[model samples]
Target: MPDMPTVSLNKAAPPPLPPTYQDPQLLPEPRRCDTGAGIVWIRKAFDMFKQNIGIWLGITVAMFAIMMVLTIVPLFGILSGLVVILFIGSFMQAAAIQERGERLKFEYLFSAFSTHLKPLLILTLLYMVSIAVFFILTFWGMHLLSVSNFLEARVALDSVGVSSSKQWIVMLYMLIAVLPMILLSMAFWFAPALIVLHDMAAMTAVKKSLQACLKNWLAFLIFGVVGGLLSIVLMVFTLGFGFLLVMPMMLLVYYTSYRDIWTDQPLSIDA
Candidate 1:
């Protein structure tokens, strides 16, 4: 067989080989507060707080009202109302962020109710399932102890030839109940991030939220514990001016974590 000449991009010979294409970088540095990314975000959040206070306050009020109703009303189907809120959140939140300069608005959130219903519904189901799991584990653990208490214990031990202390049984159940508090916090730690950043379906956002925490389990658990302790301390000291600091800090932590994992892209400087 004759040896074949190499093809090249040079016009005089064969065309030169095409250049290799490069993909955009993944796993870029997250915008950390130490890098002043958090500072810029703090500024933006300040603007967000200042301009969207009324919107947020109103939404908060509406939500609180719904919660109150759920607690007070029997079979009023308040779970359904919660789905309404999550759906409304999709549009209301985006509009509130975008219209931070507008200062005051009434019907902006109403529009979200109709427009973002699909993703909102998915998120609602996800949230419901997570909450259900949290409660189920909590109650089941409690019941497990109740069944093993006193009379039940005497009956079971007579059959099994073993014994247990009331204190130990109670303590074990307490630990189980408390475990959900931490799991619930971490499980939904990225809920808002998934809802806002990825525009993921509710089930997926919830699952991803759980996975994100598992991947960064220690940090996420520490965040909840420290954040909770600090919030209580601040509440004691500042009569809730603390929320001005607390809310922003909490949001920043989640936002930074989400950016690091999902986007993993550099932020462009403001033009």
Candidate 2:
């Protein structure tokens, strides 16, 4: 049996990393904590972000502009536009993780297209399926409740009479709505993390994502709720400029929190 490797957080992270990375280098070989400054090397990787937010932001905007163009710019076919966008986004994410000088450009977004397209698409579809399944299950449950409480409720509305039947159905619908939120949220909990950190088929990533969430439901929920609320506030208050800050913070938080699995050691970073 291979030795169970020990993970030491905040240790040696690979060099030439981008500045926006506030995480300690997480090596797959021997998993490590996301914080890079304890029992390990203590260096912040976000120098690029702080020093060049303008240029980086411009690049991101350009990429978004290209996406807008594709909607109108007729291509050989829909496939052409989709393929281009997918490559663009994936490459951008992956490239952001590459060495400093080459990090966070519109060009980076297209990096993963040629080599990592199929797996990335598969993972994305798996997340979509999880979403679809959540809705389907909730809808079915609601339909059943509605049937029992509303129209055709008690076939003979005259004889199978019950007081406040509509109210009862409404309660049931609420319960149904809440049920999937609790149950299915776990399935897609770490989907984005899995997609970015590992390469696998969509179905497999979905399975793993669910497993990861179930394994650490409490922690994930806490993380999700806090992040979600912050996002909502940002959207409302700043009219969305808040996304620039919120996005990076949540991304790092998700990445850090997700390291919970596949390693024993823990390192904490403040949100």
Candidate 3:
């Protein structure tokens, strides 16, 4: 029997490991939050806002001024809508930064502009089309109504010593326009966060946002009512200066709601 020689092999350390690729599609589904969570989210946001009110206020004011300037540009005034959507995503990013215990910077105000500008701009265009279609339908409905009641409308106007459908048209448009706009606003509420934070496409974000709203419509309804009242009171008490505080806090609250839903975890007060 011959003894076999055992050879010891030196194994070189494996080349420095490269970063692992993560699955981008592994996003968590949004959780169902209770109606009370709306107020909790608001409180969380206000606490976050208190940490750097001055910076938040400055960012809010700057955003306002930029949007105002954009609004005044002639022949290209429509560009402001796109700018507004981009800024909304930027502001959400800003809130996310603050939520993560990072120092908020002025640059966060433009973060989305660099990262998700095109999709956000397209989101704005979709929003515009939504509104425009609603407006046209409203105008058409009013036209039909006016035609159906032409004689009665004329008699009523003559009784009031007024002539012309212009006033009625304007009134009808105002009344009819608000409902669709509010519905659209709710549906689009979470789209920016979904697009910027989750890296979703415009239409995907819009659809998911709308579905999230529909699923949580009751909570949103309560939040809207209570939050609207709180906003009015805050605005009144601070003589409009509160807007500087309220505006950013509201945005943070919005981001909080989106985070809570999408991540399936509510942020703690201490967080």
Candidate 4:
């Protein structure tokens, strides 16, 4: 008997993959927010702040000190912004824990350092790069303005109480500096939460953040305006010590906004 010929099957080759890397996509749309949601965010933040003011204050101070130290380090100093990213998750965790009726502890602020280090560090680098670009463009614009004598008008608006050339320079610098920072802030606003809480990649989280903000720009504008005014009033009335209390509340507000805008279900307010 002749041996049967062995059968050879040619398996279909896997399709070639695309060369470009695609960013992680977010939900089709963000949760809808109303104008009143902005105020509600501040209120909820205050509630969270009240739950653990001491712990919150301590965490803030410690983080501030850490940031200062990082900024002073020789080579790593430029990455100090990245250092701040390391703690953003911790702060959000602390807030979430408090919302869950748990006692806030200082250790909560360091929790993300253990698990989310890589993405957070990458985010920090991107954040730092954005800031660097912002400043570079800001200074360059100012230089161009100065060199071109663009602002050399004899009459000053004096609307914001500027009278002298020195004042004009300072005011002009500030005006020029604000636009880029505003853009950068909006773009990165939700990136930390997405990266830390939702496990998104750095660039993907950034795109989601920007998308979420763009989808709810009006609410954000209201929040920024009203929140800023209220914060100023609080600080002024309390001779600036109020800022310590308000600072944590503001961060919580930011986190709350992220939750409200990004989460699908109705936000649960801890009783």
Candidate 5:
């Protein structure tokens, strides 16, 4: 009988290509969008708002009521930041659910609490710290400017009919000082969505959010300008009550922008 073909088991089949290595912590690289993409974000957000107007209004009312209650309780108002973070995450989650063709539910407003409470809280803490640092630095810088002869120069200029009031100078200083805070806001803009959707840590989420915003600064600039103008119009036409509507729409825009920049599929609403 032909010698049984010698079967060589010497080589374990090369370890099945290590199951496609996937990093659980991997995050998407933020995309740089065209400047006009800002307007597109608003349009998409508006479409989402139209689809769930009733639920959106209800969530807005609930948010206002809760925030009012928190504000009424002495010292508890500080928790408002945490509440806002949770609400933001919930809004992102709701948008995702709605994108799946499901009807929006009021309960979505509180859903983040169960799944992402800790990270949301951490975000709030970081927010508070940022505010504190802003104030501290602003005041300290003002003090330095005040003592550095800047005030004297202003006075001399005023005396020369330059019409520079100390109040105006301070206002200008404050406006200039707020530039950094605006950047900080950009850093934090997408953090809640990142935390809720990606399960990213607070710090990591903030860093990524900032990078995303910086990469799309032109788009954000357009967004800011258009949003500001729209807000003014809404406020004027509706006697400030428009904020209730504006607030929800703004949150939708936040979610839409996050989806646009970080995910392969952006949220869409049917015409």
Candidate 6:
């Protein structure tokens, strides 16, 4: 018989290693960026979106679908905040992967659930509590204002002509009520990314995020104005369909901003 060729069994090659930066590191204090950096962050995010448009769209749609489902189901809507936190962390992870030249996959959307779920959930709970406190205080303050207004109006009716509707009181109340929630949002703006990327504790991450926002308030103001205008334009031109693109881009912007402010090594636009 002809000599049989000897077959050698070789083990499958090990899977490629993830990007080294994925490992948690001790991040420095957030940097204060120039106002122009806001526009740069948005442009970089758009570049990231263009690099993997299809995947970005898919992730956005998936997230929207999940949120809708949660909203429609009774009592389950409460979970929407938790879902948002998870997705935020996942988006940060995806951004990191893309920054390293890796192709972003849809599977990355759920990666946070495995690695950072607990802390993310804690963040969500804290947000919910803050919202609840806001609503309670708003109602209580409104009631007190109404009573005071009523008493003052009666006094005015007896004295000079009837006072105007006291609309200023309502305006003042609204301003006061909104301020705390704005601060709450600032505290949360970068907390998820800090927890996901730097492995910071929940409270510590919230503190850092707030400090970062205050440190770079000018940049954030610019970012908010530009992003708000873009959102309005998209909604007007696309009749709301543009949210399919805007949603993902918003997450990418967040990731880019976090990287720019929190890390010594920020992602380049070209990257």
* Best of the candidates, TM-score: 6
Per-residue accuracy of model 6 over 1-271 as CA lDDT, tens digit each: 8999988689788899885555334457777787778888888899889999999899888987999999999999878767998998998988888877788999998999999999999999988888899899888877876776656645655576654455644556678788888889899999989888878899999999999999999988898899999989998999999888788888898888887788877654344
lDDT of 5 by residue, 49-144 (tens): 999899999998898799889988999987765698888888888887787677789999999999999999999899889989988998888777
lDDT of 2 by residue, 20-102 (tens): 63433333432323332221111121332455566556555555566677666776344434454254345335433542234
Evaluated at residue 97, the lDDT of candidate 4 is 66
- Residue 65 accuracy (lDDT) in model 4: 84
Error of 3 at 51 (Å): 1.8
TM-score of candidate 6 versus the correct structure, residues matched by position: 0.82
In model 2, what is the error at residue 17, expressed in angstroms? 17
| Candidate 4 clashes between residue pairs 3 or more apart in a chain or in different chains | none
- Model 5 misplacement above 4 A: 1-27, 149-172, 267-271
TM-score of each: 0.56, 0.57, 0.76, 0.74, 0.80, 0.82
Score residue 159 of candidate 5 by CA lDDT.
88
Tell me the tens digit of each residue's lDDT in model 4 across 77-163.
866666677788778777666655567788988998987899988888888888888888888887887777555632454545557
Residue-pair clashes per prediction, in order, are: 8, 17, 0, 0, 0, 0
> Against the true structure, candidate 4 has what lDDT?
0.77
Model 2 CA RMSD to the hidden true structure, in angstroms = 12.6
Clashes of 1: 8
Worst 10 residues of 3 by lDDT: 21-30
Query: Whole-model lDDT for model 2 versus the true structure?
Result: 0.52
What count of clashes does model 2 give? 17
For model 1, how does the per-residue alpha-carbon lDDT over 1-271 read when each residue is reduced to its tens digit?
9999988776677678986533223232222222334344334444555555665556545644666777677786666556554534543344334433344454544454565566666666666776788898778767765866546655665567555656655666678777777666666665654665445566666676676666656545455565678779987899877765665444545544454444543222340
